[model samples]
Target chain A: MKIEKTEHFLNFCCEMGRHLVQSGAEIYRVEDSITRLMHAYGYTDIEVFAIPSCIILNIMHEDHNYTKSIRIRSSAIALDKLDKLNNLCRRVCRETPDIDTCFAQLREITSAPLYSELVSYLAHGFVAVFFTLFWGGTALDAVIAFASGLAVKFANTTLGRMNTNIFFTNVCSSMLMASVPLALQYLGLNIHIDMIIIGAIMLLVPGIAITNVMRDMIAGDFLTAMSKLTEVLIISLALAIGIALPMGAARMFLGVM
Target chain B: MLRFLPCLYAFIACASFCYIFQVRKPRFIFLCSLNGAISWLVYLLTDFLPVEAARYFLATIAVSALAEILARALKAPATIFLVIGIIPLVPGGGLYYTMDYLISGDFAMFTAKGLQTAAAAGAIAAGASMVTSLVRMLTWRKQAHAQS
Candidate 1:
C-alpha cells in the first residue's frame, strides 16, 4: 500500500478501536478487532493495545512506522452500536472493502440515532418501579420509586451536560435518590423507604463497570481490570456518602432515623 | 404462581434496562430479559443453599452460561446480555442495608451486612469469570485444531 493510503487505513483502524472502547466493548475485543482488521488488509506487522480510556495502534509498513493514539474521556453502554460495529468489522474482514466504503459505514454506525430522551426517562422510571416491586416493595413504594427514578435520571443528564466528573455526578444522583424517599417518608406517607431508595439507587449502580472488570481480568488485561475495579470502588463509596448525607441530615433535623 | 412474581418483575426490569442500554432490536430485548428472569428464578430455587453467596454464585453461573449461548446464536457480543441479565442479582439491597446499619451506629450488624455484601459481589465476579474463561479455553482449542 502507498504511504498515503497506509496512513488513512491506520487512522481508520484507530477510530474504529476508539469507537469500540467508547461503546463499552471489552479491552480484548477492541485489541482483537483492530488486529484482525489490519490483518485482513495484509498488514502483518501491526500492534493494537486498548484500555478503558485509551487506545494505541502501531503499524510497520515499508521502511516507516505509523502510530496513532486516541484518549477516550467517557463511555456509555450502547449495545446496539456495539453489535453494528462488530458486524461491520466482520464484514470488512471477509470482503476487504475499500477504505472509503469502510469509513462511510463507520460514520453511519456512529451517527445512528439513539432512543429519545422521553423514552429514556420512562425506561428509568420503569426499571425503578419493577425493581422496587421485585424486592417486595408495596405499590406505594413503587410509585415513590418511579418519581425518584425520574429525578435521578434528570439530575444525571443535567450534571453530565455541565461536564461534571462521574464521581460528583453519581454523588449528586445518589443524594437525590436518598432524599426523595426520605422526604416522602417525612411527609407522613406510609412507604418502604429502604425499598424505594434501593430501587432508585439501581439507576446509578456501576453494573457495567463491575461486569467489565471481571471480564477484563479473565482476558489477562489486568491493567484495565484494575482501573475498572477502582472505578467500581469509587462509585460505591460515592453512593454510600451520598446516601449517608441525606440520612444523617434527616436524623439530625427531623429525628427520622 | 405467586412464587414466580419476582421473576416476572426481574423480566420487566431487565427489559427496561435493555432500553436504557440502547438494545434496539425487539428480539434481542426479549432474549436478554428472559435471561434475567432465568437467573432470578435460579436464585429463588436455590434457597436450600446454606450460604447466600452460594445462591448468588448459582444465579451468576446461569446468567453467564445463557449469555454465552445467546452470543453464539445471535453473533452479538455476550457482554450485551451478561451485563443486563446480572442486574437483578447485584446486591443493591445489601448495599442499602449496610449503609443503614452504619448510619444507625450499629457496628455489629454493619460489619456483618458489609461482609455479606462484599461476599455477594465477589461471588458474582468469580462466577462470571469462571464461565468466561471456560468458554475461551474451549474455543481456543477448537480454533487451533481447525488451523492445524
Candidate 2:
C-alpha cells in the first residue's frame, strides 16, 4: 500500500476504535475489535491500546509504520449503538469491504437514532413503579415513585441537552429523586416516602459502572478498572450529596423532625 | 398473586431498562428481560434459605452465568443483560435504611444497616466475579486446546 493510503487506512482504523471506546465498549473489546479490523484489511502487524477515554494504535504496512491516536469523550452505555459497531467489525472481518464503504457503514452506526425521549421517559417511569412494587411498597408509593422518575428523567434529558457536566447532571437528577417524594409526603399523602425514594434512587445507582469495574479488573485492565471505580464512587457520592441537601433543608425549614 | 408480583415487577424493570439502554433488537429485549426475571425468581425461591446473604450470592451467580451464555449465543455483550438483570438483587433497600438511620442519628441502627448493605454488595460482587473468572478460564482452555 502507498504511504498515503496506509495513513488513510490507519485513520479509518482509529476512527472505528474511537467510536467503540467513546460509546462505552470495554477496553479489551475495543482493542480486540481494532486489531481484528486491521488484520482483516490485510495489515499483518498491528498493536492497539484503548482505555475508556482514548485509543492509540500502530500498524505496519509495506515496510512502513503508521501510528494514530484518537481522543474520545466518554459516553453512556448504548447497547444498540455498541451492537451496531460490533456488527460492523464482524462484517469487515468477513467481507473486507473498501475503505469508503466501511467509512459509510461506520457513520451509519454512529448516527443512528436512539430510542425516542418519550420512550426513555416511559421506561424510567416503569422502572420506578416496578421497583417500588418489588421493594414491598404500596400502590401509593408506586405512584409517588413514578412521578419522581419522570422528574428525574426530565432533569437528565434537558440538562444533558444543555451540555452540563455529568456530575452536575447526576446530582440534579438524584436531587429530584430524593426530594419529589419527600415534598409530596409533606403535602399530606399517606405513602411510604422512604420506599418511593429508594425505588427512584435505584434508577440512578450506577449498576453498570460497578459491574464494569469488576469485569475490567478480572480482565486484567487495571487502569480502566481504577478509572471506572472512581466513576462509580463519584456517582454514589453525588447521589448521597444530592439526597442529603434536600433532606437537610427540609429538616430545618419545614421542621420535619 | 401476591407471591408472583416480585417476578412480574422484575420483568417490567428489566424490560424497561432494555428500552432505556436503546436495545435495537426487540428479541434481545425479551431474552434479556427473561434473564432478569429468572434471576429474581431464583432470589425469591431461595428465601427460605437460612443465610440471607447466601441467597443473593446464588442469585447473582445465576445471573452472571446466564448472561455469559446469552452473550455468546446472541453475539452481544453480556454486560447489557447482566447489569439490568442484577438490579433486583442490589441492596437498594439496605442502602435506604442505612441512610434513614444515619439521618435520624441512630448510630447503632446506622452501623447495622450499613454493614448489611456492604455484605449484600459484597455477595453480589463475589458471585459475579467468580462466574466471570470461570468463563475466562474455560475460554482460555479452549484457546490452548486449539493452539495445541
List fnat, each candidate: 0.78, 0.62
Model 2 whole-model lDDT (C-alpha atoms): 0.83
lDDT of 1 by residue, A120-237 (tens): 9999999999999999999999999999899889989999999998789989999988888889889889898889988888888887677678889989999999999999999999
Q: Per-residue CA lDDT of candidate 1, range B1-148, in tens?
A: 9999999999999999999999999999999999999999999999999999999999999999999999999999998899889999998999999999999999999999999999999889889999999999999999999989
Q: For residues A119-208, write the lDDT of model 2, one tens digit per residue.
A: 999999989999998888999899888898898899888898899877888899988888887787677777887778788888888867
DockQ of each model vs. true complex = 0.85, 0.70
- Model 2 misplacement above 4 A: A1-3
Docking verdict class for candidate 2: medium
Q: TM-scores of the first chain across all predictions?
A: 0.97, 0.94
lDDT of 1 at B37: 96
DockQ of 1: 0.85
How big is the positional error of residue A257 in model 1, measured in Å on the Cα after superposition?
Answer: 3.4
Output the lDDT of residue B131, model 1.
Answer: 96
